[model samples]
Target: MPGRIDARLQELGLTLPVAAKPIANYVPTVRTGNLLVVSGQVPMRDGVIAYTGKLGAGVGMDDAQAAAQLCLVNVLAQAKAALDGDLDRVVRVVRLGGFIACLPEFTAMAMAMNGASDLAVAVFGEAGRHARSTIGVPALPGDAAVEVEAIFEVA
Candidate 1:
């Protein structure tokens, strides 16, 4: 049996979306030793960017949070792909980096990132907790509302 990730997803009424394909020359994720470094994930589903806009401007805090959730979904999708859909190989979530294109006055970046943090804990248990940086940016490609990257430990 796999880890509790599937159950957790059912509990949350969410399903991990398919991992987004690389837009440029980089891969979606890479593994080296015990670490898996995941590229930044934008809020895309079904090969389409679901939310594309700046936070605190064209997008709201709620929208940013949802986009952040999609980012995590993409992250998990990448992890599952890397582990051959066997989440049992995961060990820990090392770190997460989130970037939001938002208005300078927007002060709820952390709150928006709760989506990612919450999902991590739900899927990876205590190991999901990690050091993170949630920073505001002036703009992002495709005018995306949020972006997230992560590092994970694996067997």
Candidate 2:
């Protein structure tokens, strides 16, 4: 039988992609005690960056938000892999770190990050209400519009 988290994902029509491999030297996730830390994930789909460019330049608000949501999806993929494919092992969403690639004048970082936050709560309920940090950056790996990383407390 599918776990609660898996059922929730299906109910929401969200399908996590395969966990992405590290592009650099670091592993995708590291577990120390009950804490699982997921490295930053960009908006990659089918092995390619799905969203690119700075937010205030060519990317619109909706696309930037979608990019943020996709980043979270990737983060969840890594977490699922680390937990033996059982998302129900997650106890709490400790924190989320978001980086938005945007022009210097852009100041909608919070709005963009809401994409991930909303989805997190949707997927994990109260456990997904987490502390978060969102910042605007000049660029990110693969020139992705957004990147998200997370720390999860697991069983």
The TM-score leader among the candidates is 2
Q: What value does the lDDT take at residue 39 in candidate 2?
A: 99
Which residue pairs come into collision in candidate 2? none
Residue 86 of model 1, lDDT score: 73
Q: What lDDT tens digits, residue by residue, belong to model 2 across residues 17-70?
A: 999989999999999999999999999999999999998899999998899999
Model 2 misplacement above 4 A: none
Q: What TM-score, to 2 decimals, does candidate 2 have?
A: 0.99
In order, the Cα lDDT scores of the candidates are 0.86, 0.96
Q: After superposition, how far is residue 17 of candidate 2 from its true place, in Å?
A: 1.1
Worst 10 residues of 2 by lDDT: 60-69
Tens-digit per-residue lDDT, 71-149, candidate 1: 9989888988988887767789999999988889988889888888888887778989999999999988787889999
Name the lDDT of candidate 2: 0.96
Q: With candidate 2 superimposed using the best TM-score fit, by how many Å does residue 25's alpha carbon deviate from the native?
A: 0.7
Clashes of 2: 0
